[model samples]
Target: MQPIILENVIKNYLLDKIQVPALKGIDLKIDAGEFTVIAGPSGSGKTTILNLIGCVDTASAGKVVVGGKETGTLSEKQLTDLRLHTIGFIFQSFNLIPVLNVIDNVEFPLLLQNTLSPKERRERVLKFVDRVGLTQYAHHRPSELSGGQRQRVAIARALVTRPQIVLADEPTANLDSVTGQNIIDLMKEINQTEKTTFLFSTHDHSIMNQARRVIRLHDGKIQANA
Candidate 1:
């Protein structure tokens, strides 16, 4: 099954008793193991699309099918379960718990699942942490790390569950050019080696250049998908 599919999806938000349309009939599909980007400026509905696919929001019209299931038909509990088990998210903010160290932060997601034993959880967390090249800073807190390093922690945390799909929202917007490229390369390597499907939303042309496929959006509509 495709990791993400949107068929004539529309999203509208109420603002001051008026409907503000965010997405205008967006039709897209992201195949499994594909490295793709949704590129657009602000207000072009990048985050809206991600939210729909991530099951954080429902579509106002049409369908949003994720991992072979239509999101509109899923119960709240089912959506929660799908997100926890099938999808990983890496935000631009690096949403790490300030109080948690590297190991604790990465282990946070696994704690939600009962399928893994404590020892197994630690092993998975350590495996992802080491995969992101943070083995030396496994004990460091978010405050002690650099922007790039903190993002690495976020990557490890997102991947610890071994999700089929990873959604990154402007992940490199907060880093320097060099550091941003490094982060992109790391994600690309993971996408290739682990065969993880990656869908990124960014306005960074540098990132667009790195994507195997780029879907450009403007004014809440698709401009290109190539």
Candidate 2:
């Protein structure tokens, strides 16, 4: 079954008095465990699509479905729960808590759900920290880590929940070319190994080349899906 599906999905934002349509109408289906990239120039709605898929925003019209659940109808609390349970997000800026150490930063999402005990969370956090080669820096805070290391922590955090899907919005934007490539490779390996569906929103051709399938957006609509 497809992990994600969108049928004429439309997302619009109210900027002051104007209605800025970020996604005009989109129809897309991403199969389970697929590595997909949504590519487009800035202001072309790529990030908007990612936000919708990640359940950060609701579609204005049509359907946005994830894990066989219809998205447009979910309540805010339900959507939040869905995001927590089914999806993981990697942001471009690497949004780690300033005060938390690396291990705690990675375990923070699980804490939100209050579903796992401290021992379980530690086990989960260590597993991913090792996966991302950050086990040695477990006690270091975000301030003590380099950009690449911080991004690793971000990736570990994204996967700590064992989410079925991961949505990355310009995840490599702040990294150097070499480090960005490393992050991309790490994501690819993890997706294949863990059977997690991966999707990225980026204009970087380097990233597009690495992705198996690419969807291009333009002016709030998908221009090409291939």
User: Which candidate ranks first by TM-score, i.e. highest?
Assistant: 1
Please list all clashing residue pairs in model 2, or write none if there are none.
none
| lDDT (C-alpha) at residue 68 in model 2 | 80
**Which ranges of candidate 2 are over 4 A from the true structure?**
none
Give per-residue lDDT, candidate 2, residue 164: 87
Q: Can you give the TM-score per candidate against the true fold?
A: 0.98, 0.96
Query: Candidate 1's error at 160, in angstroms?
Result: 0.8
lDDT of 1 by residue, 1-226 (tens): 7888999999999999999999999999899999999999899999999999999999999999998899999999999999999899999989999999999999998998668999999899989999999999999999999999999999988888989899999999999999989999999999999999999999889789999999999988999999
After superposition, the stretches of candidate 1 with alpha carbons farther than 4 Å from their true spots are none
lDDT of 1: 0.94
